[model samples]
Target: MRPFAFERAPDLAAAQRVVALSASSRAETVPAMLLAGGTTLLDLMKLDVLRPERVVDINALAGRFGGVAAEPAGLRLGALARMAQVADDAGVRRDYPVIAESLALAASAQLRNMASLGGNVLQRTRCSYFRDVSHAACNKRNPGSGCAALGGCNRQHAVLGTSDHCIATYPGDFAQALVALDAVVEIEGPQGARRLPFAGLHRLPGDRPDEETVLRPGEIIAGFLVPAGPWARRSRYVKVRDRESYAFAAASAAVALDLDGDRVREARIALGGVATIPWRAREAEAALAGQVLDEAGAERAAAAAFREARTHGDNDHKPELGRRTLVRALLEAARMEI
Candidate 1:
């Protein structure tokens, strides 16, 4: 890892000042990086993928943005709240099982204990080429260079949202839950605080695959707001991987259903591990809007989910795998007694 300076910010204002200083300094190749749990930043740094000149520690700001609370309107999750805290919260477990289950199924207990909700959502892709600095063809790592995954072994890469420049998959479990529930992300920066749809946070790899998010130069994610809904309790997240534990999903689905008798009143669907971004399968949700939860309906919804999925060589099976995963999740959610 490259030598870098580290400093801790006591408050949000101090953090902003540090960011401003870094932005003004032309010495650093990249802007100042934020350090929360160090789960993502440290790993990339050690790999020499991210050689930031300065890292601003934000753990001190937890007291201001690290609480999980249940509000009458919805659930509010502070960005710094640990994954374990949010997953084990009674309110989250009971009210938003998809969110809890997604967190519980991610990483190991040790990582869940250390990683924060905000950091987890912003985690980088797991593409081997992108992580290994030896590969000089990863567009995400070095923009305008090239993408080796497009012609190489890309079984774990994305199929849904991909550009010629990059095909790295969005590798987060919690973001799928947030997208399915239509959660809103709260961000604070030097300009001010703003709320945006969770779906809008991630950007597709158009030309500049390196720019992964819509966050401004100095914006930091503060918290997430998941609105309360009749379908939240009946939600489920199904992750399909080569192995059960400690493996990233090959294809995963977060599904929520509000049923009137045997017919669906409303259905929400989001897919992960097979897309460039947290993919909300709105077409599939629409297919099940008034349909009964039967085999035919499930198949139809699944087909709709992957209707627009584009796959490369090795990942050609992902569309089928993703379809099956979503179908199973929808069926299971339909039977859930919420």
Candidate 2:
């Protein structure tokens, strides 16, 4: 790993000040980077993909930020709360099974114990070209340089939110759950605090693929707020990967449904491992509204979900796999004994 200045931030204000002082126009290229779980940050740094001149340790602030509270109204998850803690919480597992399941299915037990909820959502893509510095072409790592994955081995790349500039998939399970549940993200920055829809946290890989998120420079994700809703109780996340465990998803779906007898009252669907950002399938939800929850309705909703998917050479099967995953998740959620 590259040698850099290290400082432990005593509080949120201190952490913000350090980052804001070194903030640049582009968030990815910021000279000073925050250190939370260090799962993603340190990996990229060791790979030479990220070369921040300074590393600010924010664990000291965890005392004020790390807690999981589940109430009748909603769930409040502190950004610094460890993934394992939240996943194992009785309230989370009982009340928000989708959220708990997503976390439980991610990474290994060790990583889940160390990774923070805030850092987990902000984890970067696992594109080989982006991680391997030897590969000179990756738009996410280098702006306007070009995307090698376009013509190279891209079976793992995205299909739902692909642009000519980039096809790297957002590799997180929790974010999809958040998007499906309409969770709100709390952010603290140099300018002050703000709450944004969790769906709006990630940006599409347009011309500027390097700009992955909408977070302003020097901003720290404070926590997440998931309001209680009918759909929250009957939800599920289905992930299809190359392996059963400790592998990134090839196609995954987070489904939450509120049923009116055998008919659908509301449906919320977010797809992961197939999009540039946490993708909410509004079209799919529309198709299922007021329809009977059955195999035919699930098929129609799945088709609507991937209608806009654009795939390159090796990843042509992604759309179909994504559709099947969504169908399975919806069916499983319908069977939930909520």
Candidate 3:
């Protein structure tokens, strides 16, 4: 890692000042990245993946942005809120089952406690080529360099929303669940505060595979507001992996459906492990609307989920795997009866 100066910001204003200073100092616009729990960021620094000239420590502002508050409309999860705190909170478990399940099914207990919700959402994908410093052609790590995963070892890469340049998968379990619940993120930047839908946060790798997020210069996510809806309670995050333990998803689905009598009233679906972004199955959702939850309906919904998937090479199996995962997720959510 390259040597750099480090400082702690006592409040949001001081943090903004630090960022502004970095931006104006002939560095990259929004030059300094905020330092949170150092779970993922520090590791990248050590790997020479991110060599920031200055690191702004936000630990002092931790208490201000790490609280969970429940409201009639929905829950507000602060950006600095620890994963363990949100996952184990009774309100999250009772009100947002998908969020709770996703967190509980993620990394080990230690990581969950150390990693914050915001950091987890913004975490990089686990693509091997993207992580390896040896892979000089990783487009995600360096723009216009090229993508080795295009025709390389890409069995674990994304199938949906892929491009000729990149095929890396989105690798967060909790974000998938949040996408299912239609969460919106609040961000503060030089342009002032703005709210962005969770779906809009990530971008598909078109030409600039390096730029992944919708965040502008110096924009930092403040918190997340998951809109409370009918399906928030009756939700489940089903992950199918190589193992049943703490492993990344081979195919995962987060489904939240509101059952009215024997028929589906509303459905919110987002998939992981098979897409470049949180895959929202709008067709599958439409297929299940006003339909009874039966074997046929489940299969139809699952099939519709992958209607437009553009799988190729070794990832051709993902469409089917994703279908089954969604079906299983819907079935699991139906059993919730909440």
Candidate 4:
């Protein structure tokens, strides 16, 4: 809303140079956040949450920067790839079913068409305290001031990987599915282009809830690399909300199972709406390995995943919801053939 300069970038190199030249003097070099469809950024700016000095539009790089490729090696999704494109793509709906389902389950049709893959992955949590200017005590929005969610009405706060300083949940469905599949992100910056496993891309809030991702100041996400794995073909993303119509997940699970004659050969599980970040449930996978996929087995696995969950008052029901969501997701995934 405030006065800020805007420029449409011609290419990645030009975009990179524009960012470097504009932001080099700042302590952290990226002067302007690359603007895609501006769904998240613009929303924040309107709310006065984020007021970047400049806006760099990558509209011209659409064709050259966005596409989804299905290969023997894996799936490659360009950074500028639109959410609707990936969500509705036949390859995504057929092969990476969980990914498609997750995308379809988020926001709305218009926002999905406008939002980009990279922007969605980097979107911040939707904590109420962090959004309102009156509640500037939020540690995520303003560090060391105080945490409003600590004792405030926080039913949607995180249950896992939470510190006293912060407990805001990572509000993304697609990231959960991708992390479940062990997806990797390709990034380019001042140093050069490189790849990072999805698990390494996110960071725990720790004491500094201000910092979220591992991305440097001037870095840009290039693409997402999904390894051709057993779970990619047999996966399900299940979300549970209060009303179930364009609502954020109260508890969700992204589950992929490889079953062998009623026994689990392998499984990949990640939980959202219950963690500080996209939570990969290695414990749940371990519990399912070599075990059956019956109701009892699913319950056991779900319980294992939430075994270490430390929840607070008013939202203690999340652990139970997380367990039920996982159990249901596992059953749905087990039923899927190919």
Q: How high is each candidate's TM-score?
A: 0.97, 0.97, 0.94, 0.95
Candidate 4 global lDDT: 0.87
lDDT: the better of candidates 1 and 4 = 1
Q: Which candidate number maximizes TM-score? A: 2
lDDT of candidate 4 over 1-338, digit per residue (tens): 67678888887887777656544443222357678979898898788777677888987877866899999998999889999999999998999999999999999899999999989988988988887878968787787878888888778888999998899999999999889999999988888988989888989999888788887756778889998877788999999988776778899999988789789999999999999999999999999999988999999999999999887787889999999999999998898877
Q: In model 2, how large is the Cα lDDT of residue 51?
A: 82
TM-score, predicted candidate 1 vs. hidden true structure: 0.97
Model 3 RMSD in Å is 2.2
The superposed Cα distance between candidate 2 and the true structure at residue 214, in angstroms, equals 1.3
Per-candidate alpha-carbon RMSD to the true structure: 1.7, 1.3, 2.2, 2.1
Candidate 1, residues 153-240, lDDT tens digits: the string is 9999998889999999999999999999999999999889999999999999999898788877667889999999999999999999
Error of 1 at 157 (Å): 0.8
Supply the global lDDT for candidate 1: 0.91
Query: Candidate 3 — number of clashing residue pairs?
Result: 0
In candidate 1 the C-alpha lDDT for residue 34 amounts to 78
Higher TM-score: candidate 1 or 4?
A: 1
Model 4 stretches with alpha carbons more than 4 Å out: 17-31
Q: All candidates' lDDT scores? A: 0.91, 0.93, 0.85, 0.87
Q: Tell me the TM-score of model 2.
A: 0.97
lDDT score, residue 8, model 2?
88
